[model samples]
Target chain A: MRTKNQKIRDFVLSAISVIVLIALWCAVSTSKPDFFPTPMATIERLVKLFEKPIMKVSIWGHIFASLKRVLFAIGASIIIGVGLGLIMGWNKKVRAAIYPIIMTLRPIPPIAWIPLIILLFGVGEFPKVLLVFIGSVFPILLNTISAVSMVDDMYLKVGKVYKANTWQTLHHIVFPASMPTILAGIKIAISSGWMVVVAAEMLASKSGLGFLITRGRDSYDVALIMVAMILIGIVGAALSIVFSFIERRLCGWMSS
Target chain B: MASKDIKVQVNHLTKKFGDLLVLDDISFNINKGEFVCIVGPTGCGKTTFLNLLTRLIEPTSGEILIDGKPADPHVHNISFVFQEPSAFPWLTAQQNIEYGLKIKKKSSEEIKSQVDKIIGLLGLEKFRNAYPHEMSVSMEQRVVIGRAFALNPDLLLMDEPYGQMDIKMRYYLEDEVIRLWKATGSTVLFITHNLEEAVYLAERVLILSNKPAKIKAEKKVDLPRPRSVSDDKFVEIRKDITDMIKWW
Candidate 1:
């Protein structure tokens, strides 16, 4: 079919573009060998990193540590954020009371809260998770609020005409209508969560991808830092791919 | 017509937005299992009338009575199919059809049987498992209509359900709607700007004036079932309604 052929062509085009980017990186690195690590050298270092341990954990161990923190934070944020967002969207009184406070807190960068968070929770997993939670929760909450408010009034009328109760209307109509936008917010939240977790780990942590990079910087191991950086990019991309797959499955109707 | 019981009675239904009245002292009675089409000029508050009937909006002064009591969606089984396709995109065709039954807390077996029957009736069996995005526009509207009819509502309200479709699809869906209406024996009040569609579908066509929409005229179409638009009688009825709807 034409679509299949077009998909294959698209794949090939994207592969070629990536290859060109790598070739450009190779050329630039060759010209400044002392400062920049070549793509080959970085790949070699990445493979070598698996054999050894950084801060008493291997590369996979560090990835797991970061993953554990980010996933926990994102999970908690989703539960709290979605619940609060839906309630706020449905109830004008609640929205009037809480939205102003949320708006005030949302603009401050998660990193700016490091000192206060550290002072309260210490340099433990709790503080790092909280930092990521702060970074991710607002976008998810705000997006959910907007999505809930923007659900077509026509759909609500359908619910009403069916004699659907308030609970049924929210469950059946409002929730699904808001899903695509909420999924988009989750995508954004994941990336922001990743960034915040790295910054938190780099500031005060012993075993994470972020700490691996910071440790490399402290010890002047540029190749090790590059390895950690590349791994972080790959992991972030993989997470995004997972979210996109879920979004496609859940929100297939929007695309059509 | 004299023997048929009145299913819906609108008594002095008036709606005003601030100083501007949209509907003025509208009173009508729809007979049990009757198919009635309302036609009016563009922006003549035709939808406002339907909305007030469904209580999507409250009337300034009026009452919509069903079965000798004030109409309440909670107390009555009412379904509405909007002009635009209102199928829930997240649900498959089968699930969309089952939505009302599920909301009413019907048993799983009941839901399945009802959904299966409606899907078959709508000719959506081929696309029952397909999501809204996977189907064509007309097919999506079929799903929407199927969802409404599956509830076997006491009253079914449609607001120009085929206004967006081409002539071919419109004719096909119009027939499908007629089939569904006859099979279910539900009282239907369909609103449209298309006079031919009104004449084709309704047993009686209600014509409304410009702003502050009131019933200007009501024409009875005594044509037999499966009526033809090309028939001389159909054209004459369509022409009569068209002339009544003209503002200038």
Candidate 2:
């Protein structure tokens, strides 16, 4: 429940967005009717979409498929990326040995792997998951490496003076101190994974929200395409919001 | 190990930064339970002298002895407080104060008791749970000093610990340092650019010359306890040190 002032503020902001969006739709629809849909028509089509079967092969199905692929990719990236990042950051010898390989591989786009991915993993979940992992892993690895390496030397000295062993120093000081930047990287990873998974699914998978959008485009159902697009936007926004909330709570001490 | 025993002895300590000789064959002995201040001009390498004593940086040549043996920073039991309070951002005041003891592997009971004593001693009970960001600059510095003192080190090395403070806060913290020094009876070697601060706190004031920094002058400040800046002899010693520093 919002207070009266809060309600007013929200309504005003929402109204401003609606007005701007309507003006944009009007301009685009008039200028290029074939490529654009009016605001009212899009809303009516969206309502028709919600009225369809809510159970099997519905929005829930697309949502679940997309979410499952995203989670798998994120999990894999965290495991491999954080492990490699820790090694590279903590050990100079390891950093020297592996950094060149990482730098060389990091430049290739995740989407550019579509042809290779289809050849290797076929038109299945594996390709989409792998693409998402590729999208998410580099930022997490780089951020973690930089964050851990940049911890103040004084703190390390203090730990040594107290006779803290190697494991103790890493666990108690290094990990906690570098967590803010790591969490920011995690937020970026999740959002990027979602985006990359959608593109990967459209190119490979037979099912999922991305498939729905591609199929709708083929069949000339603009309403279905618009609905899928809106779902993507909403999910992306929600994921970013959730990650930001977690980041704020986890790194709250820094603000104080 | 100190038991009404020897303090610090730096023997033939020659520290060079590449080709530049910072501390050239320097040697000094500090007695147990003494407050000694080193004063020098802006670029005289007073900071380098303290860093050698603290073993933050290894001396380019020669060695340091605490209680007539080689100094091990880990076991020699010296706590350093830098000019700026460097409380870890993530830890609250209570946690920061207890960090050294926790690192030394003290039992929880010991940590609690020591933290409680220092919090009360420094009048920091109100902000006990506050993080460094939440406290004023002076309060943050107070916590830094309190934390160092809680270690109960045999020797306390401070590098211009109150240099970043306002005049009023500086005096108040100086008095606190004096009070803590008297209470613990730990040997303290303080470095400062402020001539008045050096004269105010130390039994002996050692002044260093410009780069290739060596001891240019030394004065024994024989003032009584609870000395005031307004006192005639105190002002006189401060002026003499000021003049010596100007000469450099």
Q: Model 1 segments beyond 4 Å from truth?
A: A1-44, B1-4, B232-248
Give interface RMSD, per candidate.
1.3, 2.2
Best by TM-score: 1
Which pairs clash in model 2? Answer: none
Candidate 2 per-residue lDDT, tens place, A110-150, comes to 98988998898788778889999999999889888998899
Of candidate 2 chain B, the 10-residue stretch with the lowest lDDT total is: B1-10
Model 2 off-target regions past 4 Å? A1-14, A26-55, A152-174, B1-4, B236-246
